[model samples]
Each structure stands twice: as C-alpha cells, then as structure tokens.
Target: MKKLQRIFIYTFLSLAAIVSIFPFLWMLVSITNKSVDVTQGRLLPGTHLIENMKTLFATVDIVPALINSAIIAIITTILTLLLASLAGYGFEIHRSRGKDIVFTILLLSMMIPFAAIMVPLYRMFGSISDTAPFIGIDSLGAVILPTATTAFFIFFFRQNTKMFPKDLVEAGRIDGLSEIGVFFRIYMPTMKTTYAAAAIISFMNSWNNYLWPLVILQSPEKRTIPLLISNLGSSYSPDYGVIMSAIVIATLPTALVFFLMQKHFVAGMMGSVKG
Candidate 1:
C-alpha cells in the first residue's frame, strides 16, 4: 500500500512538472522554428534562432522597452516593500482601533477588481497631470503613482508580522528606542525572510503588469516588455520565431527573481507558521 502511494505521488508530481514546464519548452522550440513550422507543431530547435532574434531586435525598440520595464519594476518593488512593511508593522505593533480599521479597509481594497477602477484611475491621473503643480502626464511617475499603495502586499506583510515577536519590540522600547527606531533596528532585521517573500511577489506583479502600463504609457520609447511583446505579436504579420524570442526575453527577469526569492521565501513561510 505504501509503495503504491509513493508511486502515485511521484506520478502526480511528474505530470504537474511537465504541465508547468511544457509551455516554456514550446516557447524555446518556437524561437528556433519559422512561423509555419511552429504553427505546425515542430517541437525541436532549429537554426532560425539567430534570424528570429535579428528580426525582433531590428523591428522593435527592445533596448528602451527593457530599460523602462527594469526601472519601473525595481522602483515599484522597493517602494512597495518599504511602504507595505511600514504599514504592516504599524498596524500589528501599535494595536489601535484606528489602524485596525484602516488595515481592514486596505484588505477590502484587494477584492476590488482593477477593471472596475481603471477608468476612474485614468481620469484621476489625467486630473493630476493637468492640475498638479509638479508632475505632468506622459511621465514615468504616471506609471509609478497608481501602484504605490498595493492592498495585497500590505495584507501579506501584516499577516507575516503577526509572526513577529512582540517581546523584541517591547525590549527595544525598554532600551529607549523610539517606535520607528525599534521597527527599523529590531523588527526589520528579524523579518528578512518576510521581506524577501514580499519583494518577490511585488516585483513579479510590477514587472508583468500590462493593463495599467498600457493605459498610462503612450510612447514607444517608454513602452514596457509586455506591451512590446504584444505589439510584436500583432504587427501586420506575426513572426512566431520573433514572438517566441520576445516571450523568452520578457519571462527571464521574473524567473530570475523567483529563483532568488524561493530560497528565502519558503523558509520565511515556515518560520511564520511555526511562530
């Protein structure tokens, strides 16, 4: 019976792994084949990779799109981590009614679909650009502003913070540290795993975000990777080889970030659960 169970589990896992990885494998195969060959289900690599890459780069402003994606993703990840962590720690440690209410509202915001809010958000951005004293429309800040406060990240941090040792905060306070200092010096250091997990999630979302970015960014010079990929696929006649190359390029950053975060992410989740 135990042998049968083990066999079943292994079979299930193998099937799952294949399901998850098949698309990526198909993408690589697509990159190596011509459009007709790819559509006809050629599953092997071909000599077309170099030609595909040449066409993709030549027809697209690949460099600028890549730079814009990297810039927005990195900035969004850093700011989301900082702000979300701060708010999470505050709500958890302060233990006040007002903050509790605010946290609940923030969590509720997570349930609101982006599609429902997108039009109003676009209008708000337009207003900010038109009347705001400082920044204007068509700026990168336009892309960054709407995402500064992410409900999901805030909730993730708050849940993780429940696992934080309050005794550490009390001890820091007893030692004459202010609330902010205690958060920075004591809590932050202890929650490295939590930060790692949050950073991964936030970075992936920001990096792969397409709709808001599509609406906010109007210039090809400032387009992101996802937009570039979509446009690459939608030109007069799509080139499967080139589109496949773009998918691979666009998918690499998130894959790298996931690998780096996975090492620490599981450990953090385990720690939180134990605490």
Candidate 2:
C-alpha cells in the first residue's frame, strides 16, 4: 500500500511538472519555427528565428514599447514599495481604530473588480489633453499611477511588519532616531527579504499589466510589451513565430526577476514565520 501511495505521488508530481513546463517548451520550439510551422504545431526548431525577430521589429517599433514597459514597471515598483511599505508599517505599528477601519476598507476595496471601476477609473484619468480633472491622462504616468499602490503588496508588507521587533523601534527611539529615521534605517534594512519579494512581484505585475494599460495607452507610440505582444497576436495575417518570439521576450524579465528574488522571497516568508 505504501509503495502504491509513493508511486501515485510521484506520478502526480511528474504530471504536474510536465503540465507546467510544456507550454514554455512549446513556446521555445515555436520561437525557432516559421509562422506557418508554428501554427501547424511543429515541434522542431526552424531557421526562421532571426527572420522572425527581424519581422517583429519591422512590424512594430518594439524598442519604444520595451522602453515604456521598463519605465512603467520600474517607477511603479519603486512607488509601491515606498508607499505600501510605509502604509503597512503604520497599520501594524500605530494601532489606532480609525486606521484599522481604513485598512479594512482598503482590504475590502480589493474585492471590487477592476472591471467594475474601469469606467470611472478611465474617466478619472480623463480622455483628452487639458480636459481631464486628474493627472496622468493619456501618458506613461497614467500607466504607472493606477498600479502604484498594490493592495496585496500593502497587505504583505503589513503582515511582515507585524513580525517586526518593537524592541528595535524602541531602541531606535532611545538612540534619538525619529520615526521616519527608524523606518528608513532600521525597519527597511531589516526587511530586505520581504522588500525583495515585494519588489519582484510588483515589478512583474506592472510589467505584464495589460487591461488597464490597453484601455489607457491608446497611442501606438506609447505601447508596452504586453500591448505590443497583443498587437502582434492580432495582426491581419498573424505571424505565430513572431508572436511566440515576442512572448519569449516579454516573459524574460519576469522570469529573471523571480529567479533573482526567489531566495530572498523564501527568506522573507521564513522571517515572517519567525516574526
């Protein structure tokens, strides 16, 4: 019976691994195949990889899109880390009824689907130049602003802050450090793992964010990778090779971020457990 159970578990794990990895393998295979070959599900690499890249670049100005994505992702990640971390620290450390209610409200706000608020959010950013009441209408700022404060990130930071040693806070106070100084110098440094995990997550989300950006970034010149990839997919005569190549390119940064931050992510969660 135990042998059977072991076999079953191993089979399940193998299946799961295959299921997870097959798409990426298919994508890689497709990247090196011609458009028609890819569409026909050829599992072998072709010599069209270079041609496909050339076709993609010729079809869309991918350099600009890549730049736009990088700018939005980097700025959004930084803002999210700073604001969310501060808010999280405050919620955990300050202990006030009003703030608790506000935090709970923010938590509840997450349940409201972005689709439901899409109209208002879009309008809030405004449509044309000088007509919008709020800032960031029809610009990269618009792309970065909506996602600047990720709720889950804020929640993650708050939960991590709960593990923060109050003794450290008091110690800082005794050493003549202001609250802001303690947060910047002490709490921030000590929570490196959590910050790393959050940074990777936030960057990936901002990088891959599609729906809002799709709706907001109307100009072809302002397109991001996701938008560019979508554009490639929707071409009148779609080039599967080119699309797959774009997918690979689009996926690399997120993959790199996860790889670089995986250790820190583990450390952060472990620290959270200890806290």
Candidate 3:
C-alpha cells in the first residue's frame, strides 16, 4: 500500500511538472520552426531561429518597447517600495481608528475589479492634459500616475509589518529617534526580505501590466512589451516564429527577476511567520 501511494505521488508530480513546462517547450520549438510548421503543431525544433528573430525585428520596434517597459517597471518598483512601506509602517505602529479605517478602505479598493473602473480611469487620465498641469495625455506620467498607489502592495506591506518588533520601535524612540527615523532606520533595515519580495512582485506586475497601459498609452514609442506582443499577434497572418521570439524576449526579464528574488520571497514569508 505504501509503495502504491509513493508511486501515485510521483506520478502526480511528474504530470504537474510536464503540464507546467510543456508550454514553454512548445514556445521554444515554435520559435525554431517556420510559421506553417508551428501552426501545424510540429513539436520538434527546426532551423528557423535566426530567421524568426530577423522577422520579429523587421516587423516590430522591440527595443523601444523594451526601454519603455524598463522605465515603467523600475519607477513603479521604487515608488511602491517607498510609499507602501511608509503606509504599512504607519498603520501597524499608530494603533488608531482613523488609520485602521483607511487601511480597510485601501484593501476594499483592491477587491474592486479594475475592469469595472477602467473606462472611468481612462477618461480621467485622458483629460489630464487639459484639466491638470504638467501631466497630460501620452506622457509616461499617464502610465505611472494611475499605478503609484498599489492597493495590493499596501496589504502585503501591512501584513508583513505586523511581524515587526515593537520593542525595536520603543528602543529607537528611547534613542530620540522620530517616527519616520525609526521606520527608515530601524524597521526598514530589518525587513530586507519583505522589501525584496515586494520589489520582485511589484516589478513583475508593472512590467507585465497590459490592459491599463493598453488603454492609457497611445503611441508605439510609449507602449510596453505586452502591448507590443499583442500588436505582433494581431498582424495580418502573424508568423508564429516571430511571435514566439517576441514572447521569449518579453518573458526573460520577469523570469530573471523572479529567479533572483525567490530566496527573498521565502525569507519574507518566514518573517511574517515569526511575527
């Protein structure tokens, strides 16, 4: 019976691994095949890799889109780390009704689907040029402004902050440190794992974000990788080889970020557990 159970568990794990990895393998194989061969489900790689890359570059301004994606992801990450950490620390340390209510409202905002509010958000941003000064339509600000206050990050930070030691806050206070100083010096330093986890998650989300940017960004120069991929997929009779190459390009950075930060991700959860 135990042997049968062991065999069953192994079989399940193998199946799951194959299911997860098959799509990426297929994508790689498709990249190496002619468009017709890929569409026909030729599971093996062909010698069309270089040709696919050439076609992709010829058809799309992938480099500029990559730059735009980088700018958005980097800025979003920094801003999210600063703002969300501040808010999280404030809510956890203050112990006030007002702050509690505000945090609840922020969490509630996360529950509201972005799709439902997307049109209204789009119109508000579109009129920014005429209605607001400096930040107008078609600017990077258009992409950055809407996402600056991330509700999910707020919740993540706040939950993680609950794990922080109040004794440290008291110690810092005794040393004549202000609340802000305690946060920046005492709390932030010890929460490196939390920050790493948040940074990875925020960076990936911003980097991969599509629908909002699709609605807000107007020019090809400002479009993100996902948007670029979408356009590539929509072209008249898209060459699967070229599309696969583009997917590979679009996926690499996020994969790298995830791999580098995975240890921190686990560490962050452990911090939360220790709280």
For each candidate in the order shown, give its overall lDDT on alpha carbons.
0.83, 0.84, 0.85
What lDDT score is found at residue 225 in candidate 2?
92
Model 2 per-residue lDDT tens digits across residues 1-275: 99999999999999999999999999998888897898787988789889888987887688899999999999999999999999999999887999999999898877889889888888877754476423455589877887898667778898888878999999999999999999999999999878888887778788889999988878788899999888877889887888888899889887876677778756544543354
lDDT of 1 at 37: 96
Task: List the candidate 3 regions with Cα displacement exceeding 4 Å.
Answer: 1-5, 131-134, 266-275
Q: What is the TM-score of each candidate against the true structure?
A: 0.87, 0.90, 0.90
Can you write out model 1's per-residue Cα lDDT over 86-158, one digit (the tens) per residue?
9878888888998888888878887899999988887777887867723345667777777877877777777
Q: Which rank order by lDDT, best down to worst?
A: 3, 2, 1
**Weakest ten-residue segment in model 2 by summed lDDT:** 127-136
Winner by lDDT between candidate 3 and candidate 2: 3
> Highest lDDT, which number?
3
**CA shift of 164, model 1, Å:** 1.3
Colliding residue pairs in candidate 1: none
